[model samples]
Target: MLRGAWLGLLLTLMATPAVATSMNAFRERAVTDPHGLIDAVRQQLDQAGIELPPARERELLWGMGTAAINSNDDAALAEATLRLDGLATVANDPVAAAAAGFLRARHDIANGVGDGLGEALKAADKVLGESDPEIVAWARFQLCDAYALDEKPAKALPLCRQAVTAYRALNDDYGIGDAENDVGIALATMDRVDDAAATYERSRQYFARAKAEQLVVMVGDNLAQMYLKQGRAREALALSRASLKQELATGRISDALNSSADIARAEAALGRHREAYEQMRKVVAQARTAGINGQLVDMLKVESRLAEQAGDLRQALADEREAARLGSAVDTPALRAIEVELEQRYAAREKELRISELEHANELKDLQLKAAEADAARRREQQQRQRLVNTTIALLAAALLLIVGLLALLLRAQRRHAAELQAQTLRDPLTGMANRRAFQQRATELLGSPREANAAPHVLLLIDIDHFKCINDSIGHLQGDRVLRLLTDYLRTAVYDCCFVARIGGEEFAVLCPQAGLAAGMRLAETLRAGVAALVLPQDLPVARLTISIGVAQFDGTRCHDLSSWMRAADLALYSAKSGGRDRVEASKLAG
Candidate 1:
């Protein structure tokens, strides 16, 4: 028997390279030509009397199964897994057997076959003591995925994290990305929103760096779903749209369907319920045609909600019923019986496992439980710290608001005080008329305006009280002030409403009429002179009458270009008026 075994081993070793080469070729072709590769693999499996090395055969079968899974060729995966199982049993190779079991478990989970979770647990047990680190990592990943699919996130998280550590240790970027994605899924399922978003980002970066476009899309889909749940519907919509585009470009119809469903959910959340219902209806049809029952049921349920929101109550009810029917159909008796049979087989094999192996597994479970407890305690502590921080922030915000309100009040008070000061600067103290500075500003603004064709020229008038020094010499200066005030009151009532009057100097006043020509200015100046002469002094005053002289100048654009030149012309006219006679009006020759 030993000699026969040695002879068989020698023959198998001789044929190993050719079989390995063929398997590598098949794997390479699987992406672009999956159906052809599947046919070739099937033919190779069926070929009789073509004995290959047991190890090489196991390697080929495992590669083929993995390729089929990646290509989504379920039929080919099932056949390859079945063949690998039979070969592993016949060859009595523990590592090969464990690898085969892991592949079968992964296949079942991917296809939503009978008792995927149970099969995964059995496969994990089979590979528990396996010396091969790669197979052990993969088994952990598969089991993690199974738990995630079953909605047991609490059970799934630790396993997924473990798989991440294993993949990191193996320096496998693709595996690390895949494991991290599962970790994100588990975290999202547990409602740890921030952690899940961070994990998904990490996974997406890893996949991007590894150039795994499909895996990146997978991570994006999960992240989009999380965003939607967080009420960030616009972000989810953008991500889902991008993912859908990539999935369609890559010919990943199933993934594209998922992305479309996510988009519909996001649209619904964004209050586009009618649009969401239309999109979800199409996704449901595609899912049904693709035979993706689990996703179809989810899509149908989403469609029902969207329909209800869209005011299509009848369609909503129909979709709800279909979803229920499909959900019930997913857990048939035949699938359950298959699951029971797998569990029984796993149980029978469990009894033959070594005591030390069982102890190691038990210890691992205990460590996991302890880790979970520690994590919970840490989370509670973090929550306390967060509450404290939030309280501090709230207090700080309130204080900031108080400071801002006080500052605003101070600013308003300063502005009001400044406005009073500005008014004081622009008014004469005694007369309450525009001062010299205010007169100059107003005249400059009037002169700066465009001169329209055939428009009336602006006029400036300067008036001076006559014999003001004699009045002060005869009476007291206080009485002279009273006389000056009496003249100011006469001027106020004498000027036209169009005139801008200002006390440009002591005992002197100027008026700027923006709509008046030289003739109007002379007329206004004469009126002021006559009005002051006609003013009656109070009974207490010694002076019997008050009088004034006036100067008039017109500011046509060609004659006076600016306020300075215009004032000079008006001052010259005032000098002529003063030289000619008191209580008289004079017009400048420079006037337009």
Candidate 2:
């Protein structure tokens, strides 16, 4: 029996290279024109005049199966998988039969849930019993994949680790790397984020050492996606862009689309809004053309957000509507029926689980309730004894109130008088504005401080009534006071939501404009300048016209230039304005 088996194996080994060459040729052709290659292979196999050995015939069927899978033509795959399965079964080749069965099972699962997962497991077990370590590792990987697809990654992870160990024992670096990549994905889904990233890096290093460019590209993309989830946008952006350029050069359109999507997200994070929008547009178009409903739905939603960032609300809404439409259209009648069946099964299972949990909870609650009842009986006796003491305490408190009432009134009057005296000191007395001390204190609180991301930068505007002494001497002091009040009204009105407005000194007012920066401050100063210039000061006031010189200072978003420094900058700029003949807006070097 051993001699016979050795002879059979010799013959099979001699025939293997020719069969493999044919399969490889067909695979290469299928990459560019899968349907044409499929049709040509089918025609050759169907020809009655052609005679081929069994091994070569099996190779043709396997090639056709792979091509069909690549084409996403389910019917063709079904036909090829069935023929390969029957031929391998009769040929008594466990390896060939296992591979054919596994492919068919994966195809079934890819389309929807199928009955062949058990069969796939059985085939994998047969392969595991074989002597080839590499083949056993591959079978273990397939088993891991089955568990992963069933949403049991924790079960799959041990198998994945075992596969990696087996591959390492055989010095199969490529196999080890691919298995580790699988392990990383499982870990990531298990929420071990740091472990997943480290595993991915290890896999990437192995692929790089092996000079497997395609595998390296795949690993790089996976790592970049992980970085995005970690909020490391800059790193993700760099890796994605580099990999995308390489993938595009290699004609990997699908991979390029995925990379482009990643690039969009990173660019948006980096504030390259328009570039991000363009990248997302290309991704949407490619996904739409590919007729990939899930990718299309995802890309459209991303595109909608990009549009919103670009301030194109109409386009954003339209994209959202289209995404919604596509999402609804993805649920075909068959898929909808399957979903409904799953939902029903889930509900029934959940109801049973809830009942079991509730029964357990009720037993615990009953024990606690019995304990509480004993405690409550003891508390009732204590409550009855405390009631008699409460009435005695209330009578004593009423008798003490009469003794303290007059003293409380006199103390309240003195406190009121002192509070009024303190208010009078902080007041400007003339224009009802905050005095200089109060102005400086309030300005220090609002300005000269770092602002939050959503908060406004602080701006300080210093106003000097141009030639105020002239106005006071030429017009009486009352008229000058009226002019100051007129300017005060403009300052309060303009700087209401602008934070603080005060008269820091006579004829010099300060307004702390929170959240306003250079351009905003300049515009405001120009407005206040224009507004005061345009003011008639009322025909009743002694002054015919009023003009003001102003200086503006704003925080540079770093160290808060203390209020004094900010004031000095504005004061210097104010001096420049005065020296340059007044009634103008000027920004300090710090402002620029």
**Best lDDT goes to which candidate?**
1
Give the TM-scores of the predictions, in the order they appear: 0.50, 0.42
Candidate 1 stretches greater than 4 Å from native: 1-51, 70-72, 94-113, 329-592
Tens digit of per-residue lDDT, candidate 2, span 513-551? 766667777888899899999986687776767888888
Q: Candidate 2 at 118: error in angstroms?
A: 7.5
Give lDDT per model, in order. 0.69, 0.66
What shift in Å separates residue 343 of candidate 1 from its native position after superposition?
Answer: 9.1
- Which residue pairs overlap in candidate 2's backbone? 456-515, 457-515
- Residue 477, candidate 2: Cα error in Å is 99
- Superposed Cα RMSD, model 2: 25.2
- Candidate 1 lowest-lDDT run of ten: 1-10
